[model samples]
Target: MLARVVEANERWERLAAQLREENAALRAENEWLRERDVRREAELERVSAELAVLQRLVFGRSSERVRPSSPAGEDDDGQDDQSGQGDGPGRRQPQKASPRGPGGRAGRRDYSHLPRVEVIWDFAGGGYCCPECSSPFEAFDDHAFEQVDWRVTVRVVVHRRRRYRRRCACAGPRTVTAPGPPKAVGKGRFSNGFIAMLLVERYVAGRSQNSLIAGLARQGAQISSSTLAGTCAAAGALLAPLEEAIVARNRDSWHLHADETSWHVFTPDDGDGPARWWLWVFIGADTTCFVMDPTRAGAVLARHAGIDTTTGQLRPAEDGGPRRLVISSDFYTVYASAGRKTDGLTNLYCWAHIRRYFVRAGDANPTQLAYWTRDWLDRIKALYAAHDELTDAWNASVAPAPGRAAVEAAARLDDAYTAWDTALEAIEVARQAQMKSPGLQQPAKKALATLDREWDGLAAHRDYPMISLDNNASERALRRPVVTRKNAYGSRTDAAARLAATIWTVTATAEQAGLNVLTYLTAYLDACGRNDGKPLTGPDLQRFLPWNASAADLHTWAQPPETG
Candidate 1:
């Protein structure tokens, strides 16, 4: 409490000093007669507008969520994916302040541990007396209310490891005592729990290093910000094997969702290159891997997915066998190039992204758009509806074991695919008829060009129903890191950026596999400590991998998700 108060006072003093300087400058501005009042006002307005834009760029909401004129159906059970949020305590706290109203407000809480504090209200002489009559009065009944008694307390724990020698033991009277607990950072005073908490608070909770320093100082730790940063970097380096495991696991998957977001780092891949770093997210069915690079080039995707960008070739999986891979991504040029460069690779473009362009086009030129945009939306909707029906049929018909019904479901899917083709053909015919003259406005025309460009990739999913219609899975995986990026304004150096990629890979992959990040980190760090900071490999490491991990092992190391 004292630390917070002092810090707040210091900030106020600094602001006051700034304001004082500004006031002095204003007082000395009598030379303003040099400019016309109207022009000066106009200049002030322009500066104010620019400042507002800057403020928005720096501090506005970071959600780039596209809400079309007609809302798209949810890809999940209507549950929006949150960066660090989960079902209970020890979960990731939401990075942003909750907006107003019922959705923002949480349900009734059960923080039952009320600290006892009392304030007694009584009349003169500590008695219930009538003040005007100066006479004692009997209290009829007691009224009570409850309120939170919140305060801050800070302390440091001193771990005292006692050493003792066996005084009369036959085993040479060797010195022995209980082992001291492991630390995430070697030779660090902080415990593993403290380090884990700091990590969660920083990355998952989206708190900056300076914010962490202030918070610890409030707890009387008085630690420097550099110490926390160094600890985090050390922890990332220590648990790098787990990150590699995630990437290796991704390599083994047949289908993956790939996406990337802008990041900033001082010493990027090329020192002379712009710090326009890209954070790539490749999420397999069971694993999520985050990698940072200096370019948005297809080469990063190629390198990580174990493919040769020059030729459409995949190197082999861990089993030394080539994979028949399918990649789903947004309409980025790099994704297309990467897909084309790989053999037997099916590229599925996001349908939602396709729809978003048309939606924007319709918004820009609503009158002309009504001629064919509505037709396009209807056809798209019909296609999705058929897909949903087929998906349901497949789930209902396909049995646990190979059977006649499984064959029947495959036939039914094939029939649905044919039917979808027929529907698309009808739309194409209508489009060809209108292509002669008086076609679409520039907005709609541009949108049609995109559809034409991506049709092959968008329809590639017809051969594979297992792929999603959208690249939402990968986008959702990047949300937490994106929020942290917004908060920290990105990393300071290449090493830090690389460290973040490694750490976030393990954490996000564990989250995808429904594993508790804290427990996973602790176990991983303990393993590294036991191995003298060596990376895990072979059978010893395979068991720790999420895909190979046993149910009991996951439960022991991290909480398994609740199932219906």
Candidate 2:
């Protein structure tokens, strides 16, 4: 009986050990499954966020304004409009003012700048006879009306250069013919004015070469697309020096707005197949410059901004003095990298871009994160409002080497600065607090990370009051090129791309100066023609720059061209 008892106890011990081992294995498996589930959930959230962004891009409104929902029982009218007027019950809504000022009907357009053509109608008998009485009616006064006329005619100009024969038989040729009118191209059929028109229509107006060719054909001028393209190329080359001058002037500015867009160049493969080029714009106070580069790297920035990549320093100015510049741009790494490398180079990030991040985040999960996104957008909007107030105060202040008005304006500016500072601090504090929150979502966290990373740049605008909160200037400058790219699909070759950059620089800079694009281009191309179809340089080029241009020249260019 004792031996049987020992054997049973041993079997029981073995069964207990097996149960313990099985329990340990099950726990290990469960832990691994939990970890894998966590990873998959994270991946799913990320993908869902990406999908939401893509959907918003495709179907959402382009404006970034975020309208928050009203609280519990409030109606839509509970919120005041931009003018602080509400349409709530018992409140009289203000009527919209007439756009025509004091009258319901819109005023007629003034065509005084256009040339007038007089056409008189008279009786065939030179006098009108009254039907009731057999008497001739004599007119003492005439009733008149004005009608604007438009006519576009393309005609061949035959330059009949007179020839003089040497009657005395001097030691020269028998006949001496006057030089033919300066041609924009060597032996090309198109005149300088024609080339200028083509450029204005194609580049400034964003018309495609094919469309221009067809238009010319309709006007009884049969010109091939290639020929038109060649004419544009020649004009671009002639204007290349002016483009360089504009670039130099742009780089010389203390504050600048910079932006770039993708451009396709088909030929002269840049090692990579079907090379993707870039068209960059840097707009100064008075000048806008465009540069075509194969790469969108820091080197391009360095080259254009006069930064020496090797030393990470700005090249000396013409007077051999240190140069300083503040660039307003999006949060592109290249701008930041360039800023870091060069001394005295500051990068002021775009608030609009930072707002876009939070905007996207809010869009990803609107129901859950809408309030959070609204808070951030409101904070950014406050910054803009504060800046505007500051600008208004400064503008209203009188000058004359700083007087009492300036002192008063400075005080007002201080108050405005306080508001701006409060708004900025609110953002920073919220960013910090929410970044540490345990319940934060991935989208919000990502937006916070961008804000945190770009905090220094976004706040850099405080030091430079002249700079804008957004890089909208550069973005606006790029729109013309983008439109042209859409129409013409970019240049065909590397040289063509460079030429495009040159022409775009000229046209865009001229428009910014409020100069008539056609008249300005015509004058420049005519000057080029007189220079033997070569580009103007040195002092001559300076005269064409918008800021340095002569008043007479500017006045002439500003006026509307007369029609024949």
Candidate 3:
């Protein structure tokens, strides 16, 4: 009986061991399944977020504005109401409307600068007499009122050059004829003024070539598309020197805003399809330049901004000093790559771009993450407000050159800087705390990651007060070209693409200098015509640069050209 009992115990022990091994294997399998389920859930969330973003982009508004929610115990006006008392019983207080002057309408504009024409009225019989009484009336002070009128006409100008005959015929031709008027194109039909109008209409006004042709036809001028294209080409060739000068000035600026957009080029196929091109803009305080390139790589930035490709550092200035350039741009890797390679170049990433990430996250899943997105957006808004304060203080400090006022202004500026630093610190603390929270969702987490990655660049503006908080200036400079691209579907050839860039550079730079674009183009083309239908060089070209132009020239360009 003892042997049997020991055998039974051994059998039971073996059975228990088998059961333990099976349970361990089952646990491992179950854990793997659970992990797979978690991964699937995360993937689903990401896909949903992406779909939401795509939908918003396709159907939602383009504006990135987000209205902040009111805090507890505060009203919409941002006033505290801790008592929880109502304005009245069962009746809300009415909001006051904004005041508008003179029957809520804008005042009449002054047209004193326009030319005036008089029209006198008389009786039917050419006598100042009343019809009913048939009696003559003495003329009194005339009553008058003004009415603006517009008329567009097309006419041919006939240059009447006089011819004279030499009686002595002394070592010269027997007859001499006066020189004809200058022509923008050699033996071309159009005048310099006509070419200027065509340029402004197509480039400045963003009108297509076909539209220009039709408009001119309506004005009694029959012109073909080829003719207009040739005119633009001729004008572009003449203005190439000026464009180069502008580019040189743009590269010399210490601070600049850079941006780029895609452009389609229908180049001839060389065993390959059409090539994709890019349009780049670099805007300074008083200059704007556009460049067309076949590639959208760092080389374009390097070439235009004078950076050494190998070292990624700016070349030495003309005075042999280190060249320092601060570029404001989006968080493109090329800019960051260049920034990483050198100390002389600094990249200021746009805060507006960082804010856009959170904006998109909030829009993607408004029902679940609206509050979270708004909190982050509010933090960014606080940064902007603080920056505005810093800007105002800095401007005030610089306005008064050297005086007691400047001393006081400098103190205020220092205070503003301190406040700005405090604000930045608060944001950093909040970002860190939120990153550690367990309830964070995938969208918000991704947004935070971007913010963290670009934090140093976003905050770099504090070191240089002259730089702006965003790259809106460069973006604004690109609007005109974008519109033209949409209308014309980009240039047809490489040469045409380059010509577009040159003309756009001149027009945009001229506009930045507060010059009338039409007037500026007309004046420049006339100078080109006088230069024997060739591009201006040396001092002549420098005189045409908007920044180098004299005050008298600027005043003249500001006025509207007379129409006969």
- What is the per-residue lDDT of model 3 for residues 1-564, given as tens digits with 9 covering 90 to 100? 999999999999999999999999999999999999999999998998898677555555443443532233121122222222212212222322334434434423333333444544443444333334434444433344333322254445444433444444245444434444556676566667777777887888776676665665565455556657887898898888899899989989988899999887776233243567999999988999999998899999999889988877789999999998889999999888888887798989998888878867776567667777768777878888889889989888778767788888999899989988988888899889989989888888888889899998888989877677999899988888777776666766788888889989999999999888888887887788788998999888888887788999999987776675
Using TM-score as the measure, name the better of candidate 1 and candidate 2. 2
Q: What would the TM-scores of all predictions be? A: 0.68, 0.77, 0.77
Per-residue accuracy of model 2 over 1-564 as CA lDDT, tens digit each: 999999999999999999999989999999999999999999999999999778656655443443533223221212222222212212222322323324233433233333444544455545454444434443444444432222365654444443444444235444444444555565466666677777777877777666665665565444455556777777777887888788878888888889999988766556543468999999888999898998899888888888887898999988998889899999899999988888889999999888888877876667778788778888988989887876666566535236676777778878877887888888889989999999988999999999999999999887766567898889878887777777767766788788878888888889888888878877776777777878888777888998998899999888666554
Give candidate 1's root-mean-square deviation (CA, Å). 24.8
Look at candidate 3 and tell me the lDDT of residue 458.
89
Q: Would you list the clashing residue pairs of candidate 1?
A: 312-341, 312-342, 312-343
Q: What is the lDDT of residue 27 in candidate 1?
A: 65
Residue 455 CA displacement from its true place in model 2, Å: 0.8
TM-score, structure 1 vs. true: 0.68
TM-score of 3: 0.77
Q: Candidate 1 residues 364-471, lDDT tens each? A: 544445446666777777777766765665565646347876777777767776777776676567556655555445566667778878888987866666566788
